[model samples]
Target chain A: MATVAVENYLKHVLLLSEGGEELVSMGDLAGALAVVPGTATAMVKALADEGLLEHQPRLGVRLTTRGRRIALNVLRKHRLVETFLVETLKMDWSKVHAEAEQLEHAVSDEVLDRLDALLGHPRQDPHGDPIPNRAGKIDSQVYATLATCATGRRLRIVRVTEQSEEFLRFAEDSGLRPGAELSVGERNLVSGLVTLTRTDGGKIALGVAAAGKILVEPRG
Target chain B: MATVAVENYLKHVLLLSEGGEELVSMGDLAGALAVVPGTATAMVKALADEGLLEHQPRLGVRLTTRGRRIALNVLRKHRLVETFLVETLKMDWSKVHAEAEQLEHAVSDEVLDRLDALLGHPRQDPHGDPIPNRAGKIDSQVYATLATCATGRRLRIVRVTEQSEEFLRFAEDSGLRPGAELSVGERNLVSGLVTLTRTDGGKIALGVAAAGKILVEPRG
Candidate 1:
């Protein structure tokens, strides 16, 4: 059985990879985990020895099948727990991430299965992140974001890809949650700003980089 | 911030003390924790240094007010989680103890409060153990067990005090869960056996030792 620390490292690596055939740089991994680069390197080397991941000297790291499986399982527990906290417990969505971080390592597969069933096997979490199925397969279909979607086209917010408490609170206040209907009003790349008009006709403006974190799709 | 091991140690100390003024012996503490006597002693000494507990040479260890507070909080978490598992999740009462062991350390105070409310602020867990309140106060009322209660009276089972899988399975099979109404049919002191007749006209036989674990109260 992998220790909690090992599971955390693997999950962070998989998150950094972001469903792509890319290596996660040591600096980025270290930053994500809030660990020093040297500490991340030592731990990465240890994980490589266990055959859970591959480490390339001075370049980056990638998960092996075994590591990915564990990471996906951890991720499944995390998102499902977040769903339970917000949907069942009526907790604030912006705060459930921290709670889920502790619970993911503690929940058993049996309890998780029950939670999944209770939640009706939700396709995605409250934040619009797709939940990985029991088989470790995740839905990675690409979607347009507020930054690049065509202006004046009806759109539905599909995801908010960041867990920043500040941003999520703002999104909640602005009625920008997943499944909320809106349209891009203006995109000024020169000024690095994007403005959205909600179906309620409420206008919200964001910097280009922050706007990119909100994934959306053209409404029917 | 107590580590998981530290919480486990303190909880065991409180448990073995049995709600009375008594010190926990190193031998019993080690046995409960499945640690060596030396290890238990070392840990007790360290806890004493931190003023979490008072360790008396060759006598035993006892929790100070600070230690007791933490232990009670952990106990509250454990019992509340067990209640949620069985009452909300519809899990087997006999199996929830192990699950709660993992969750008690992971659940935060905020989540615990919500769960407590969600479960309608339960005062007792599934097995009939009292849950500590947020203020660290616990209900420790004493009750008679089948082994010593007056025979030939209408009685209700109040608690099953052991978490032993085999014994709990037997209890479940016998329909002797908490709130079960039954009357003692006979007590053969020489044979060390106790016989019970349920209100539904079912008979169950148990050894005196097993009978003592089933606490009860007289039904009006």
Candidate 2:
């Protein structure tokens, strides 16, 4: 059985590496796991020894095929659990991520499949993170963010890229969730602020870094 | 947060003691937890020190009021999860006990409350085991079992006392679940056999010990 630590390590690697192929720096991995750099290094070495990852000496690490398979499954469990918590339980969108973090490891494939069916096989979680399918495949398409999209043209939020719960609560309050229509009113990178104009004629200002986490697509 | 092992130990102690006030022998606790006697003793001592339980050296252990509160909460999560699996997810009743065992530890109180409401605040799980409420109170009403019910009396199965997966599967196939109507056709203690006659005119024989686990009530 994969221990929670092992599952978490692999999942973090899959998340850090785009398309599960790029090398993940030890510093970023340690930051993601909230572990000391040495601790992260030791775990990555052990995983590499187990053929779950390729630890490139001092360069970095990437998951092996088998490791990606396990990581994808854990991701599936996490996102589906989040979806269940929010959609079925009517829990707060900002709170479900933390709840799902603990439940992801405990949920079996059987329970996850049942939850997936119950949620009508959602493609994305409440935060708009794409759910990896059972075959370890994910939708990796990129979308423009508030920091990059054309200003004043109608754009719909596609994903919130859930980070801190505080950020999520703020996003929810601003009506910035996925499928909500908005356009950039102002993007002053040097000032590190962006003003979003909602379809409801509401305006909200966010830090440029925060604005970058909200993925969006232009409305035709 | 209570660790999974701590939750299991407390729950099992509550189960072995009919009213959660009786002394549960170390031998029974060990058997229920599948831990060696030494391990059970060591854990009991730790719990006693923490004021969760009272351990009688070389004899047994019993839950303190604080311990009972936690134990009841765990039981509530377990039975409610089992009910959701069966009544909502359409999972096989025989397999849900094991699934609930894992979920009970992972489910948060908030999520459980939502599930309880979603399940219509069910008083009992599909197995007919009473679910504890938010106040940590449980229904402990006693009911006669097939081994003790009057022969040829019309009876209704109220609970099956879920034990093993094999037994539950067998019970399901025998139409011996809760709410099923049946009658104790015969019970021969000397031969250690009990015959159950279903209302559909089907008959089945079980060991006296097995019959004792099937709680039933005389249908007036």
Candidate 3:
């Protein structure tokens, strides 16, 4: 049985390796986990010894097939728990992340299956993050950050990279969510702030750094 | 911040001292937590120093007011999570215990409040355990073990004491649930087995040990 700390590291690495192309370095893992590079290196080695990770010194760390399965499972649990917390518990989206972080490691498959049934097997969580299916497969979306979108183009918010609570609250207050259509109204070359008009007839301003983390696609 | 282990111990002791009763012994704490006596002693002392517990050598430990509040909050979280796991997640009641055990300590007040709202402020969990309210107040129930009931009396199952998977499966197969009405037909003194007839016209055999752990009340 893997410890919760080990499971968290594996999940973090797998999440960072989205698109199946990127390799996660020790520094990246440490940054993601808020730990020291040396700590990340030691943890990576431990995971490698447990046959859950493949590490090439000076390169990056990748998950083994077994490790990937566990990581996906953890992701699935996290998303499902978040959905449950929001839809059923009436929990604020910002508050559910921390609770789900701990619960993802503790819940059983039986509970996950039950939760999936109750939530009608949602494909995405409140934040637009994909929920992995039972087969450990995720529905990947082709999206670009709002900062990269051309001005005057209409795009639908698909997902936002979850980072800080302040960022999530800002997004929520800005009328952003999965499936929300928006038109880029203006862009500031100096400040990189993007002004957007939502389909709901609301206008909001987003800082360049915040807009850069939001994934969107052209609206049909 | 209380460690998970310490929180668990405090919760256990608080639960054992229901109705603002007296202190709990180290041996009792150890038994409840499945730890050794020496370990329980060390933990009790630590908790006492933290002002979460009042320890008397050779006597018992009691929760401080602050400790009681924390314990009740943990209970509230656990019950809410279990309800979410079963009602939303479709988790088996038996399988939810261990998962809820870990999640209870990690969930925040915000999450708990939201979950409670989602569950419509449920009074009891999947296993018929009562949930504590926001003020750390729990509603008391007047119910007795099925083993003590007189034969030929009609009663409805109120709760099950054991949360093991096997026990839940047996209860499900036997048509036992929170509102399942049954008539006790006969009791085998030698084998300690009770023969019950379900309202749905099914005959079931329950071991005396199991029956003794199941709480029920007279049917209306």
Per-residue alpha-carbon lDDT of candidate 2 for residues B94-175, written as tens digits (9 for 90 to 100): 9998988999999999999999999999999999999999998789999999988889889999999965899999999999
Q: Estimate each model's TM-score.
A: 0.97, 0.98, 0.88
Model 3, which residues run further than 4 Å from truth?
A: A186-191, A197-205, B18-20, B183-208
Residues A1-220, model 3: lDDT tens digits? 7788988998999888984956798888899899999999998998999999899999999999999989999999999988987887676787678878878887778767877988899999988899999999898876788888887888988888874678788777777777788988988979878898888778898888888888898888
DockQ of candidate 2 (2 decimals): 0.85
Candidate with the larger lDDT of 2 and 3: 2
In TM-score terms, which candidate is top? Answer: 2
Leading candidate by lDDT = 1
- Model 1 lDDT tens row, A1-220: 9999999999999999997769999999999999999999999999999999999999999999999999999999999999999999999999999999999999999999999999999989999998999999999989998998899999999999999899899989999899999999999989998988989888999999988999999998
Q: Model 1 over residues B11-78: C-alpha lDDT tens digits?
A: 99999998676989999999999999999999999999999999999999999999999999999999
List, residue by residue over B1-220, the lDDT tens digit for candidate 3.
8789988998899778764679787888899999999999998888889999899899998988888888888888888988977886666677788888877877777877777877788999998989999998897776778788888988988888787888888888777878789888998979888888988878888889888878888888
Candidate 2 collision pairs? none
Error of 3 at A115 (Å): 2.3
Pairs clashing within candidate 3: A88-B118, A89-B114, A89-B115, A114-B89, A114-B90, A115-B89, A115-B90
Error of 1 at A209 (Å): 1.5
